[model samples]
Target: MQAQIENTAGKRLWIKLSAVAVVVALAVGGYMSMSNTHAAPDVSFTNLKGEQVSLKSMRGKVVMVNFWATSCTTCVAEMPQMVQTYNAYKDKGLDYVAVAMSYDQPNYVVNFVQTRSLPFQVTLDTQSKLADAFGDVRLTPTTFVIDKQGNIIKRYVGEPKFAELHALLDKALAT
Candidate 1:
């Protein structure tokens, strides 16, 4: 009955592994749920023009802090809509900061902006400090819409939703 004993031992090992996996999954889910409810971190970084920008400076305006990369297709696709949103609300003190995570050099970002004709303040996260500060962003095109009081109103980790973004801005403006 050696074979029978070995089979039973293997089943027991499998069951133990499954239990550990479930426990880990539950812990991770709980951590993420709690983290999502908190306000985003406040961090400062430099724009392509060498201007130091922080969340504090944009305090009285609805700010869109977008994390993107030159190689990300989804980030490129959202540029036009971002431009539209900026144009529509810039007069009302809306600010858009496109923080490039991949290409840190100013020339690279400047060229990208020039080629795309993107109308917004393009910045560089040289060491990805801002990205790390906000969250461990593992994907491109992550965005955070901060309200006038510097609170993170909403966050999107993928392609931007213009309607949701506009709604947040509208609410911030109304207040």
Candidate 2:
């Protein structure tokens, strides 16, 4: 009855794997749902151009606020993709702001922006007040995707999957 024992063992292993998959799915669902309820803070960004861009004024646009530091490897690695994403969607009502952390030198931020020829607005949070307002964002590459109605719909703590992020932006902008 060796074959019978093997069949039973395989079935038991399959059932265990299926249960683990279900648990993982539920956890991800809960995490995603948790991000949909918070309203975006009424913050203003003064870009390197010395222009004021406010969240309230951008109520009808899908805004991406990226908090990044020049020294963060992950942040540096994701810059090209972020630029691509912004260029691809900027005309489709996507407003992107790259915010330099308070610790990042303004000169370095300016050099990075200039060297990269970044198309989106880049701002500096020199006093960290903007960081404090946006949920005390202390991480180097925290990103918040705010929906058209000024609600923080998605928060990515590290590098986001660009494809998934684009899909979410599509859905948010369609409305």
Find the candidate with the highest lDDT and give its number: 2
Positional deviation of residue 155's Cα in model 1 after best superposition, in angstroms: 0.6
Error of 2 at 76 (Å): 0.8
How far is each candidate from the true structure, as Cα RMSD in Å?
Answer: 7.3, 7.5
Error of 1 at 86 (Å): 0.6
Worst 10 residues of 1 by lDDT: 33-42
Q: What is the TM-score of each candidate against the true structure?
A: 0.74, 0.80
lDDT of each: 0.83, 0.94
Q: Which ranges in model 2 have alpha carbons more than 4 Å from their true place? A: 1-35
Model 1 per-residue lDDT tens digits across residues 22-113: 99999999988765644557777777677887878788888888998887899888888888999999999898899888555657778889
Off by over 4 Å in 1: 1-37, 103-107
